[model samples]
Target: MLAAIVGRPNVGKSTLFNRLTGTRQAIVDDESGVTRDRVYGEAEWEGRTIPLVDTGGYVPRSDDPFERAIREQAETALADADVILFVVDVTTGLTDVDQEIAQVLRTADAPVMVLANKADNQEREWAASEFYQLGLGEVYPVSGTTKRGVDEMMSALVEALPEETDEETPDRTRISLVGKPNAGKSSLVNATLGFDRAIVTETPGTTRDAVHSVVRYEDQELLLIDTAGMRKTSKTEGVEYYASVRSEQTIRDGDVCILVLDATEEIHKQDLSVLTTVNEHKKGMVIAVNKWDLVPKDGGTMDQFTKYLRQYLGTLDHVPLVYTSAVTKQRVYDLLDTALEVAEKRAQRVQTSDLNDVVQAALRKKHPPSMSSGAFVKIKYATQVRTAPPVFVFFANHPEGVRDSYKRYLEGEIREAFGYDGVPLTLVFKEK
Candidate 1:
């Protein structure tokens, strides 16, 4: 079941959304209208994860383009929602906008629950009674920040849903193409599939949602995800802001992500930040330096550019990068080949005996560092605990004493021994 949190600007709707979904998907700011698109996340009640959408504040009329987009997004979310959480600020009392919104929802088929948010104190709780004049239904006082009255709100909301929703995972290799706006990600998607799956536009933020398609290459079927170009939150407005949120979901859920970068534009700060997010998710990745046709080339230009990229990758420098131009189809097949190789590496697992041998060699070369007290950290065997972004557990007497430098060393040794390249490696130190 889908429930949308709807209200006017600065009424704590985004705060309420975070409380319900237990996700930082929606950005909460003191400034009004920070949330401009319908951001979707799950809310857990009892044992079920209920789907929830955080929408922009609804306005009856607006001349500004962003505000108009917000109103349209809210209306679309309201139309699809099974329940509407009409959040209002108790401290500010009821306003004309609240009444106007209530009037529109009054005729809607979905049930409306007026949430009097920010009722953290007795006086504010009493102020909630003013919303009864809106005539929507019983007013439920809530504190989005404090999380007071949230449980009761969920209890009521669960009973209001039409039925319990269970989403099934589809069987396919999911690949997400992500990058900054106007970086030619959509064009890359078209080149890979040999057809236009997403609209390639000159304007930034043309693709509002993550476009999905099923394609085949070498008899292997995979899900292709072309997502919106992410930008700084401060620069994103209205629909573009929420589009980036959806792209994050695509990265987390995808098995492999091909990060597209424009060669002409060079790498930006936002590109590195997005890569950090992908690495955090521990997904297999390949960097596609797109629009290589635009870069003026010399005998050593490509070599210098590769070094520049490696500097930015830092600890993630192990990830493979391929220079390509979707317009000219330069190295396009190489991108897919490397991406598949990355996915294979993510799923590769080393046997326990091999892991222990590699760990022993690494330890013998450079012993464990001791704590400030000079008590030596014991060296022990290791095991591959899992795969799909392979995780290795290293047993030690003092897990806390193992520094970051040592961990990086172990990761390098494991990669050299097992050939799990182009994927993030997780090393966990624990006392056994």
Candidate 2:
């Protein structure tokens, strides 16, 4: 179930969103129009995880381009929501903008609940009764900051939502397409799906929200999440900053991420920054050099480009690279296939005997560097502890003495014994 928060400027919609979602995902500030796009989060209430969206302030009619864009985003949220929370300020009473928003909400297909925000005390809570004049049913006086009457409002919200089913498939692979703006992430999605599921334009920040779509390939379901373009925090303003935050959050939630790059442009520092984020999160990743058809290439051009990219990737060299052309649909499906393969590798597990065999072989090939005291650090045994971003734990008498260089050598040996291509490996050294 999806619930959306909507109101005019500075009605504390973002604060309410943060309150409901139990996260500071939405940027809350005293300034009006801080949130200019749709930000998504999941709220856990009454043992259910409900999807919630916080939208920009609703402007009934506006000549300003930003305001118009915000209005469209709010309307889109309303269309997709299962229920709408129309927030109003009890301190200010009803105003012209509130009335205008009410008029718009009245036409929505979903049920609308009026939230009288900022009722921190009993006196202000009494004033919340005035919002009933707006003609929306069930006005609940609550404070997004103080947590007053929030539970009562949530109880009603959960009761009002439709019952959910066990429709979520367990075998589905979620692939998130993330990169900087105008990198053809959306274009690649449209080309792969053969439909315009996402809005495509020359505008750099055209996609502000992470859009999700499901498709079947070879009878296997795949969930494709298209996220907003990530920009440097120093260059982002209020809206773009929050969009970047949402994109990063999407990376953590995805099974595998496809980092799209513009083929015509040389790899930028910002691109490496994104690659590092995926690597640090221990998420499976694939680098897609998009607009491949536009690049002037010879027989060895792709090879040279791959070598250059690997230099930037550094230790993340295991991440697979694919040359794609979204405009021509060149190798788009091949990119998806590669992502699926990476996801499989991410979940691959090694038997304990095989793990120890590889570890023993690695130790025989190269003894670990001696400790500062000139004592040898002995790694007694190793075990495969987890999968899906496979993890291996090594026990030793002096675990802290194991150098990072030695860890890399052990990881290399494990990869040779068992292929974990395009997947991050976590090695944990613990005292026996």
Model 2 — TM-score against the truth? Answer: 0.72
Q: Which candidate ranks first by lDDT, i.e. highest? A: 2
Q: What's the lDDT for all of these models?
A: 0.83, 0.86
Candidate 1 ranges with C-alpha deviation above 4 Å: 1-6, 13-44, 49-86, 99-114, 121-139, 156-170
Clashes by residue pair, model 1: none
Which residue pairs overlap in candidate 2's backbone? none
Superposed by TM-score, candidate 2 places the C-alpha of residue 22 at a distance from the truth, in angstroms, of 3.3
Residue 117 deviation, candidate 1, in Å? 1.6
lDDT by residue for model 1 (1-432), tens: 568777889999898999888878788998887776546778999776677767766433447654455455445546657898999999899987777677777876889999999999878888899999999878999998998888898899888888754788666778899989888899988998899889998998788788998888877888889998888866555466557767877887798998889899857888988888889889988899999999999999889999999998898888898999999999988888888888888898788997898889889999989989999998687888888878989899899999999999999988877776678899999997
- TM-score list, all predictions: 0.84, 0.72
